[model samples]
Target: MIMCREATKLMSLKLDRPLTRREQLQLRLHTLMCSACRRCESQFELLHGLGDKLPDTDDTSSRS
Candidate 1:
């Protein structure tokens, strides 16, 4: 069984890249048994989606 720490790490990495089949399976299993991790995963997805829709504001070139 995957620990909450490792599961959380996988959840964050999922935002940046795709997980392997084994990784996906492990995370799925952990979330299935752990409600807290399940909720954390949902929050991570929501935050990541919000980030994608926001416009980039780091325009240093616009400054003098």
Candidate 2:
């Protein structure tokens, strides 16, 4: 079983690129068994969607 940390990493990567079949399966299986990871994934997706709707701001302080 994939750990919550690894599953969260996969979820983040999914935002930028499609996961490989194996990666997708791992994340899916992990989320199925781990409620906390599933909630984290849901919150991340919601935050991403909200961010997409906001206009991009030139906040240099936010960038490393």
Candidate 3:
């Protein structure tokens, strides 16, 4: 079983990219026992959807 910190990191990584089969299995097993991670997973899923609607900015763009 993975710890909260590690699970959270994997949760974020999954949002950015496709997790490997091993990673998917590990996270699935962990979440089965951890409601906190399950909540986090749901929250990040919302963020992933919102990201598509947000504007794009780059390093060349100046920050206010």
Per-candidate TM-scores read 0.89, 0.86, 0.80
> Tens digits of per-residue lDDT for model 1 on 1-64?
9899999999999999999999999999999999999999999999999999998897997899
**What Cα-based lDDT does every candidate model obtain?**
0.97, 0.93, 0.90
lDDT for model 2, please: 0.93
Q: List the lowest-lDDT window of 10 residues for candidate 2.
A: 54-63
Give the residue spans of candidate 2 off by over 4 A: 59-64
Best by TM-score: 1
Clash count for each candidate, listed in order shown:
0, 0, 0
**Which tens-of-lDDT digit does each residue in 1-64 have in candidate 2?**
8788899999999988999999999999999999999899999999999999999788996899
lDDT of model 3, residue 32: 96
RMSD per candidate (Å) reads 1.6, 3.7, 2.3
Candidate 1 is scored at a TM of 0.89
TM-score of 2: 0.86
Reference-based lDDT, residue 15, model 3: 84
